[model samples]
Target chain A: MHIVDGALSNPVLIGGGLLAASGVAYSLKKLEPEDLPRVGVLSAVFFVASLIHVPLGFSSVHLILNGLLGIILGWAAFPALAVALLLQAVFFGFGGLTVLGVNAVNIAVPALLVYFLCRWGLSAEKHLLAKRVADGLFLVFFLITIWAGFALYQLYQVEGGSWSVTVNSVSLILFSGVMAYGYFLYRRGILSVAGFWGFLGGSLSIFLTAVMVAISLALSGEEFGKAAEFVIVAHFPVMAVEGLLTAATIQLITKVKPELLHAVR
Target chain B: MTQVLGEVSRSWTLDKHQQTQEAFLQSLDPRVRLLVCVLFSCVVSALHDMMALTLALGIGLGLSLFARLPIWTTVRKVVVVDSFILVLVLTLPFTMPGEVIFSFWGWEASREGLFRAAEVGLKANAILFSLMALIGIMEPSVLGHALYRLKIPIKLVHLFLFTVRYIDVFYKEYKTMRMAMKARGFVPRTDLHTLRSIGYLVGMMLVRSLERSDRIMEAMKCRGFDGRFYILDTMKSGPRDRIFAVVSAVTLLGLLAVGYL
Candidate 1:
């Protein structure tokens, strides 16, 4: 999801812009001349992946592939994602050019972190259990980042407010419950098949939805209560569909190109 | 599925619009256009006053008209991207806390939220339209060259250039892979099968692209290509370009002064 222009305050915008600039600069330095083709191909893949729409009941959810891209590309995801976002803004009008920096940060930073956190889990073990665990950890990490960042910010802004308290409590319980269930599944190896991707995908979509809610509250200046309501009530099933789609993709990759998975690092 | 395919194809051809248009925006120096758009966006982003934001939006609309962009197409593009903003604009009145403007079903709509939403909406629309008129009408290669001349990092520009160059090719490859799957009696469904198929499609595309890039690198090296991109189209700011830049600068500065002071 793209943050529209003028939605964020100047400090956040400028801060995000600077951070994204640094990331791209670093990625540029790290980019070897020989690897330009790899970057280009991956960038194209990332761009097209966003265009793939998985059918939901009434509508469809486009593939974000943020976690997948991050794990594959590492720090390189920054520049690649930035260029894709720019084209989206210019051509399809998916995002605004003015706020491209903030949007890149929102997607790329989380992606980089996921790469660092989950790469080991994905690459270390060949069993389906490891995949499930990696995906679960990614979901857990995402949930915690959103809660700690946004819930705390809201709490500080309106000390002891009922709305802030309610959001924090709800997020903590819901997120913890998901993580616990995911861990339960991971431990039992119940989804130790092709469906592991689906489970992970579902978790990732839900995590993204939660993050979107938090962003709307924190950056978009939406009343937290309303934004949370819209996300939780309206987008619940889209997460499941996204999860299924992601699962299928991972399964396919594992079957055909096992080397690609390990080679990403 | 076709909608998605249509969008991909459409995005790839967006650069063609710059080639077709003969508007003043197209003729102006791209570097000037880039700088002005950035400056105007920053100004629009910093704007708080409603009148000032509306004024900025009017300028954006006016520019689109002058640039000879299709009005309905521009509106549709802006609306598609700013749909979330539209929701915020509509709901802010009811959700934002301030003096009650109205009440419906025990929900009080506030005047302050309405104003804030309008301000944000105006800014969003303003920037969207301005960019469509400015950046939307520029060729990607030219834009890349402009960024290079502006002293942006060489690597980033090259990546941008190559990415733009190959996006369409890879998309076509993706289409071919999907078609091959279809030819094999593959049908998309809400199951592991469909996802796996798509995954295979994506993986296949990636493998092909990696192979293709190697070939491309060889071709470039064989053609005496260096790391730098050289533009054949020379940029000389004629009196027309100079006049447009000055007018745009004055208008933007005037708006900032009026909005802030």
Candidate 2:
């Protein structure tokens, strides 16, 4: 999601920079002396979270963790995020300095959402361990899905001028439904290995229908993009690997030091 | 040259890494510097002609010099931060629409593009320089106070102040981790495994950070933080500040007028 230096129109770049500066400046003004240490840690966390990747079929998809970072940092998330992204752009060429504002705004919105969601949800008495985890995961999924919709729109504007608007609207709906169900499975813990294997057995009943779509698409040769899209979407091996690793890491943390979740602000 | 440039670039890419231009900053009100930042940005965007871009560049350079910023520091700020811009500048002939200055491959390079890119490069450099000058002249706390003085939303300003205030914590932890890696011989040479190791290391850092936040917040509450941070506002605009503002504005306008008419 890095906007290279010259990729945007000049007005957008400068305008975005000004807005980001405004946001960062505002964040700076609101900070208390005691909030310093947490800002440091949260910045570190947000910076590092974006580096972990899950391999997708054509390309790798990374967990942004903007949601989690925002959940933790509240209003303080933007400055930390801006700095982190700036560090990435400057050091690693992940984004351009020109579009640093755009990058900050993209990620900061979701991170802020996480803060609000947790602050409100956790404040409710009905919060359970399962609910907290679900809520966290749900927020991440929704945030990502929304951003993905925006991305599709941007791409459509680039690639599909006249049809772009309608494509965006329909794609967003389709994306939300698919993303939500996947998130549901994640929330229910069915995204794990044993649960995944159990769910695969039911799809076995409709295996022929799915196979026929593949056969017809392949025979026609023109519909391969659609077929490949399915392959891209259904590629479980990569996600399984990531999910297992994530689960293992979390389990390690929980076992080694449950105090991480125990001590709450 | 690539390695040395890369090393040099690595060292000074972050604007704050250089020695500040605090000498000129001594005389001004923080509020004026803050206004200078806005007026400078507005001028940067408003620039459309070569003469204007050049004049603005000259005046921005003068401002930096007035702040007593060293030439080397100013050069590093431009070279390191805007290399991508240099890349775009080089690519301009391919993308820009106008009369051809040169032809090669399938595309002809445009004279207009060369000029346009020069304008862009100049404008971009001016933005960086003017900002550096402001940062140089103003203490970050002063910058914060200046924003508070401007009636910017208190929440946003507080975040930047805190982030800048505590960035050292993250850097220190990063240093320790790097040192830990070095001691264990975890140097990254040419290998994808190294990338993976770095990725895992990054993951671990996030976990460590998440673990760190609760403790920090608890400590903040102990200090009677009711959310409002005050940087004792010591700045009241005086004669020098007024002159500085008027002179800068008039000079910028004169340049703008020369460019258009």
Candidate 3:
């Protein structure tokens, strides 16, 4: 998740920048010429991946895939993240050079976690190919499941709501349910008319919100609006639509490329 | 979208790229330019006045023109830096409570904030342009050497160098991954699906990169890379370079007074 320029102080930016630079340096130090190409390519994929946004709550959350990046780059995910973010900042102006450090930390840490889990749990199977593949699959499930929970926990903290993380059925429904839904949507629609449905459904909420916002503004006169009205009438639906769109878009990508779901070592 | 993204090439074979780089080095001492860039950033950052910020931007623009770097390129480069400052600017007229010029969602936009935004906008633009020129002039290799000579840890220099060199490598790897995905007749599934796919994609990439690193280290061992790096590069600092450094430093110091005091 981007810290959205000016989300924190300049000092934070500098501190984050230092960390990002150091993290990248650390990643680079461990790199070989051969590894360099893969890092660069995957970072580019990560770059492209983030461009595809899905609605999530009040905001559209693009996939950072940092967890996956970590699984590949290990600590080296830092440079991959930094460089990609730098490109994004330069090209899309999504983030700025000043805040590159902070953004990298946000994305790279989770990626590192996935990388470690993958290396230890999957890569350990040197002798048996079958065992490695199976174990890698298991590890991927474990990593992604944990990542889902972690993201929710983070969401709770950011929302100033109950810090209480209910990891049970409700929370599971909130987290795993979405993943399952996307899986279902993806598998069922590899092609056919489903693609349009997928795209339509993916962006439907955002489009709906726009319609509603437009209608509301048309109905209600400006200058008569209050804070409570904005939240109750405007904010909540935008958030819900955002979440739905995010879910749908992510599902679309998964459906198209199943290998992205391959278990990592 | 592709065109807007600019020409995607890491290796520049153009003579101009080399000439521009040489011209920069020919102009001033590396240490002085680095200090001026860093110091100017500091002074401009601390002050939140529009007039002062504009002055800085004007100065930066003037410098760029003098340097003979295309004005459009500088603008593009400056915008990258500007995004960081604009985030702050965009918030100013809304968050800071003052005379209400505009209000929405129970939030009031203040007159002061607008002016403050202007100040920050100009200041940030100026600082960004200056920094951009500094980077434009100095080759990443030269920077690594300079920093190393200036007592920055050798590890840091090596790290920076490796990062710069491998940046293109990562880009290439990423393209392959995308092609691989596309070959599967995959269309992106929307939300969590996309995240999951991306998650796996990034994970696979990281794993591959590290594996490649191991092989590379082994390869290097087959050659010779005793940890301490020997610089084959030798840059002679001239009297003109020393004078250039002094002038920039004095200029920055003078600019600080004009901006701050």
Which of the numbered candidates is closest to the native, going by highest DockQ?
1
DockQ of each: 0.44, 0.11, 0.10
Per-model TM-score on C-alpha atoms: 0.81, 0.60, 0.59
Tens-digit lDDT string for candidate 3 (A1-265):
3333323346666766687677766666676543443454445545655554545544554544443345434665676666666545544445445556766765665456545444443323353553444334434543554464465456545543342344222444443454344345534744222222222222222323333333332232222122112222232232233334433333343455433323222
TM-score: model 1, chain A: 0.70
> Which clashing pairs does model 1 show?
A197-A247, A198-A247, A201-A243, A202-A243
Off by over 4 Å in 2: A1-40, A44-76, A82-103, A106-265, B1-22, B189-192, B210-212
Ten-residue segment with the worst summed lDDT in candidate 1 chain B? B4-13
Q: Candidate 1 residues B31-142, lDDT tens each?
A: 8888888899999999898778889999998988988776676667776777767665676677678999888766688989778778878888888888878877776777
CAPRI band for model 1? acceptable
Q: TM-scores of the first chain across all predictions?
A: 0.70, 0.55, 0.51
Error of 2 at A53 (Å): 15
Question: Global CA lDDT of candidate 1, please?
Answer: 0.68
Residue B188 lDDT, candidate 1, scale 0-100: 75
Q: Write the per-residue lDDT of candidate 1 for residues A100-205, one digit (tens) a residue.
A: 8878887787677656755565555476566666665656655654555464546435644455456455545544554455446545864444445434644454
Q: What is the lDDT, from 0 to 100, of the residue B143 in candidate 3?
A: 57
lDDT of 2 by residue, A64-151 (tens): 5454455446666777787667445433434545557866765565455545544444333454653555555546545754664575
Judge candidate 3 against the unseen true structure and give its global Cα lDDT, from 0 to 1: 0.50
Q: Give residue A7's lDDT in candidate 1 (0 to 100).
A: 67
